[model samples]
Target: MGKLYVVGIGPGGLEHMTAKAKEAIEKSEVIVGYTKYIDFIEPLIKDKEIVSTGMKGEVERCEKALEIAKEKVVSIVSTGDAGIYGMAGLILEMKKDEEVEIIPGITASSSAASVLGSPLMHDNCNISLSDLMTPYELIKKRVELASEGDFVISLYNPRSHGRPHYLRECIDIIKKYRKGNTPVGVVKNALRDGQEISLFTLENFDDSIVDMFSIVIVGNSGSYIKDGKFVTPRGYSL
Candidate 1:
């Protein structure tokens, strides 16, 4: 029996790929992933058999990968951290009797935080607003709780053409706990092609430029900006 490897290849480019991730893909007899992510590492796995699925075909992709793993070494490719909005959990759930290995990668929040300053220096939680799997009310409740907890928040799938007012809706929920002037940072396509970062306050945040590929970071009460970088201090006495 061959092995199953769930690999997170990081953002869209090969530049941020880890050695382990590369090895998993390279060692695979078959590579399976969403079509766009498959395209990113297409060159590296050109010799291997490729299986591509559409955006809404996550379960199908994982099942196909698992079936392939029964007879051949298979790698299930994902963008960002496989555990974070990736294929790892779905694969695990379907692996009722099969063994699988999960290889982590750089999640979008951390990558965007690196581009912005140290906004995640303290406690934080990442919330995705896509509402594809999660309920909108539940996401709103999480956002409110994170704000009440004073957690530096990283929001994935913030805004999109499909959900034009989701960002505004989130901001409305956040303001109930955080100050209007709280620092906020937005990074689009982090560590990938055409990356853009926007630093602003919660009140003046511009959601117009955000899309499905963007990541948004909102600081806690103590967070601030310095030297043109977003900084969320850790409350050190020194």
Candidate 2:
């Protein structure tokens, strides 16, 4: 029976690749991933069979990877952590065989938060603004609940060409339950080249400056900016 390893390659740097992930990639006979992600790990995979897909088509991509996995040891690569808004979910949904191994990597939100201190030190929830599969109404509802419950939110797929105003709409929903002075942080391409971190308040967030490469984190009412870092007290110190 062939085995499949779903590896998270980290954001976009070779140094970020975990030892386990690199070992898996090196041992695998076949590698599958989006073209960009494939490029990120190309240096590590010199002679491995590679199959890459364009953006979108995640379900189809997983299906094809699984089909190949049934024949040989295959690795499906995802940027950042595999479990968080990565290929793991799609792979699990299409997986009939339970013999797959999941290798984790640093998620962009956590990495971004690290660069800005610990924004998720307290309770937090992650929401993707993309409505490719889910309904926009549901996304709005989740954002509203996250705000009302005072949970710090890490937003993924905050903006794209198809949904230009998605992040703006999310900010509006959040403001309905939180104050205008609520702290928000934007991290673009975290841990990768061209990385940018910006600190701002909910009232002053500029949607035009954000894109799909960025992760937007909105702090709760109790969250604050200290020493140029966004943080939420976990009550452990209290």
Q: In lDDT terms, how accurate is model 2?
A: 0.89
Tens-place lDDT digits, model 1, residues 69-103: 98899999999999999999999889966668999
Off by over 4 Å in 1: none
Residue-level lDDT of model 2, residues 1-238, one tens digit each, is 7788999989879998899999889889999999999998888887999898998868878998899888799999999988988899889888997468999998888888988788998889999999987899999999988889989999999998999988898899888988888889999999888999999999888888899999999998888898988888888755
Off by over 4 Å in 2: none
Best by TM-score: 1
Residue 135 lDDT, candidate 2, scale 0-100? 99
lDDT of each: 0.91, 0.89
* TM-score to true structure, per model: 0.97, 0.95
